[model samples]
Target: MSNVVARDIELDFLDHDFEFVGSENVSTIDSTYASQPYWKDVLSRFVKNKGAIIGSICVVLIIFMAIVGVGLNEHTYDSQIIAHQNLAPRVQGLESLGIFDGSEKMTTSSGTVEVNKYVSANGSVTGLEDTYYWFGTDVLGRDIFTRTWMGTRISLYIALVAVLIDMLFGLSYGLISGYFGGAIDNAMQRFAEILNGIPNLVIVTLLIIVLKPGLLTITFSLMITGWIGMSRIARAQVLKLKEQEFILASRTLGARNFFIIFKEILPNIFGQIITNTMFSIPNAIFTEAFLAFIGLGVPAPMASLGSLISEAFKSFTTHPYMIIPPVIVLAILMLSFNMLADGLRDAFDPKMQEM
Candidate 1:
């Protein structure tokens, strides 16, 4: 009987030692809340993305080169050196390290030394004089490197301005139209649709044809249709959000319509607005490049990447390097913007975090 009782009475902590062990492993649950704001969470997530960080760095570098470097450079983009016309790329002491390829031939006193671009007609190769072309000179002897960076700065600025215009008008138009539904929304949307029916490419082309290609002309033309896209996006966001509980609560609290839309609704929709703007930047840039490429860009003496390519295309065989640098820069700028947009989209998406 005693052996059976001992076997049945197994050791167990059915009643924990409340006095000694206390509540080390167990406790009554209490309310908890994060000390940070929602934006802080978003920022934290954005920082975690490696691609976004890299893209941000590249964008900054590009902007810095465009503004700071261009400002500091002594060689103006348009300042021509006719004597140094068609000079191939060369750097001091880096020719042996393959800065200039073997295909690069220059007329030196030593019977046409290959890859020697830093030679003047003094009959003696003094090595890297004023003839030093970092990325070579064009047929007109303009520094290709300087012009390329300048063109980038111009293109980016134009695109940025266009996107800003789109956002300002679009966001306002959309928010108002969406917030006030019924006949107003219907009429506004129909008008937008009618305008949208006409292709933007055709509009810009025709505008340039009429006004002639200049900075102001191109900017005005781009603005004509740019805001329509932004408006549509804004309208959709406002529509989706206007009926939310907070929005209704704001309205019920006697908040003015403007305050409700701008203060209450706009804050929630900032992510989408920014992401859309980022995406539009590339489009605007490509459009500007295309216009410039097809003879509708900035006039001669003012170099643009597209215009440079167009000029270089005529004698590509003679000076192919002239075109390569601009193309590469343009591609990198577009690519970095796209990467940034994607990263922002992913970072802002709550569903992605849950996954």
Candidate 2:
């Protein structure tokens, strides 16, 4: 059997050619691959996702606009022009590009303030004020353009701060709880459950009632129960990671619990934490908006997207523009966050990365 198996095998005449040609003709197969870090692989996959790239660009643009749009505008968000009250959004000529001014002015020292230029049947001018309301004016005649941008800034800030708070508290809480299983884990998890059981909105309402309605108050309220969800997620990840071979190996090596938990386990869960944060930000934004819409948000003179929508609801029939802009902004923000989070999840997935 061995002699027959070793006998020279020959194929009948075929279309294929087998010859000792140049080195280029000889194909060498290699299964070995160069070492590549985890994060590099994640980033390479992340940028390749079209939806995520577009969403990231949009988010960056929104952030930039939130930071710079109001600064470039001549009008202050709070500045009111009674003469231009309830004016509709109008983009005349190059006004949209900021190259041309479209304003109507009225002197406080003078008489009857006017609006858009009008010629009566008698050919006499009725209203004429040189004031530009680019996004038109709110009922108080404040610039919607500046106010919307300002609200964007505030909302983005809240999302960032709230997420940071959640990450700091949640990561630590979960790590400690999961790393040290048994009675300690049970106690910590029960504590988190107790906190989560209390409705966050109810807590927010109670806090707002106790404290004044302001940005700081809103922030504190949102952050109260927000970290619980993240903590649970982190705890789950740590629970899974702690039972792994490497963790046992580290324990055998006499590594400290803190070092093992942070240095060994935490790095493995970093991507998951980031993805969770991205997904959580939109929820935080929506919470702020909801609070603001019900008049439980920032106080007077300060405009949030929710507050703006509430104000717009009063004049919905007459001016729909007020509701449209804020709705669009909120929708875009939420969509971008969700898309980016999904992208990150796919990027960090080993199976998906392989695909």
Candidate 3:
């Protein structure tokens, strides 16, 4: 009901309100565009994780040393030098460092005294001054450094073989069972459950009784039941994915059963499979080491981390250094693989991207 009054608007100030600044320099493409292949994205995420990076470096270094370290010393793993038995770690150039100087304490008649083992054992350090036993010698005078790496090599080999076996057998079994569900699935699952019911220790004991205990026997023992876990995982993944839209599309397109499994389904679940395989490697290594520790590992003259630790256990009080290297190596291997698997799991998980 009031009278309307009109005033002159500031049209000149409207220019500043719509002022364009650096528009020509701006990019037209989307800055947030991050489209990449799945594995590339996974690799990028994995590398961003500091723990995974460190774990990868440790694993690679361990593998490299396992391959190259065995021949670095003149002494073979089985060579026995009675006089050099239980020699402390020594390095030619590191003697002045006070560590790894080949010195040990002895309870002489005069009381305990620390003496340079090289000088005491050889009567003179002249010819032996340059000799280095980086990890010292065992009771049998075998080079521990060589044996430690050799043992790692054997352990890695066994784990890889076992995991490979698991992947092949389990992946196939699970794919077949889960892809075609019904009576076949039930029967196959029942068989798997029956096999899984048997304890691993019992199987190993039976194998030990029937066959010679060595690398092959250990590998066989692992194979007997190791695949069950992988198969179960693969079956779960298959069951969850088989009825999905993409799988249904592939099936509707007349894709063969094997084609659907290995081609369509496998690529989708490959990340989980790889993660599971990495996790399994540490278990296999630990199992082998445990078997070796319990006097059922590889026979004497052949060294594994487990056997090395077992041999070192007797003299651990006197020569504690012998146990340190193998224990540290085993710990690092197990921890590194676990970290790597964890990183892979997170990286491959689609939920992580949203998070």
Highest lDDT among the candidates is held by which one?
3
In candidate 1, what residue range of length 10 has the lowest lDDT sum? 99-108
User: Which of the two, 1 or 3, has more TM-score?
Assistant: 3
Q: Rank the candidates by lDDT, best first.
A: 3, 2, 1
Residue 38 shift from truth in candidate 3, angstroms: 1.6
RMSD of each candidate relative to the true structure? 6.4, 7.1, 4.8
The per-prediction tally of clashing pairs is: 0, 9, 0
Of the pair 2 and 3, which is ahead by lDDT? 3
- Score each candidate by Cα lDDT: 0.80, 0.81, 0.87
Model 1 lDDT tens row, 1-355: 4554445566666554445646876777887976887778878888888888888888888888888656555688889988677777766577668766313755546675455446545568654464456778889888888898889888888878877787777789899999999999999989888777888768877887788777877788767777788888888999999999998898889999999989999999998898888888888888888888998889888887789888888868555677888888888888888888878877788575456
Output the lDDT of residue 65, model 2: 91
Which parts of model 2 are misplaced by more than 4 Å?
Answer: 1-33, 94-130, 350-355
Q: What is the model-wide C-alpha lDDT for candidate 2?
A: 0.81
What lDDT is reached at residue 261 by model 3? 90
User: Which residue pairs in candidate 2 collide?
Assistant: 102-132, 103-130, 103-131, 103-132, 104-129, 104-130, 104-131, 105-129, 105-130
Predicted candidate 2 versus true structure: per-residue lDDT over 1-355, tens digit per residue: 4554567878797556665678988789788989898889889889999999989998999999998989876788789877666675666565558432333333345654533332244667646333555677788878888899888987898888778877788778888998898999999988888888888778877887788888888778766777877888888999888989999999999999999988999899988888888988999899889989988888879888888888999987656666778888889999998999889989988576566
User: Candidate 2, TM-score vs. the true structure?
Assistant: 0.82
Q: TM-score for every candidate vs. truth? A: 0.83, 0.82, 0.87
Residue 125's lDDT within candidate 2 is 60
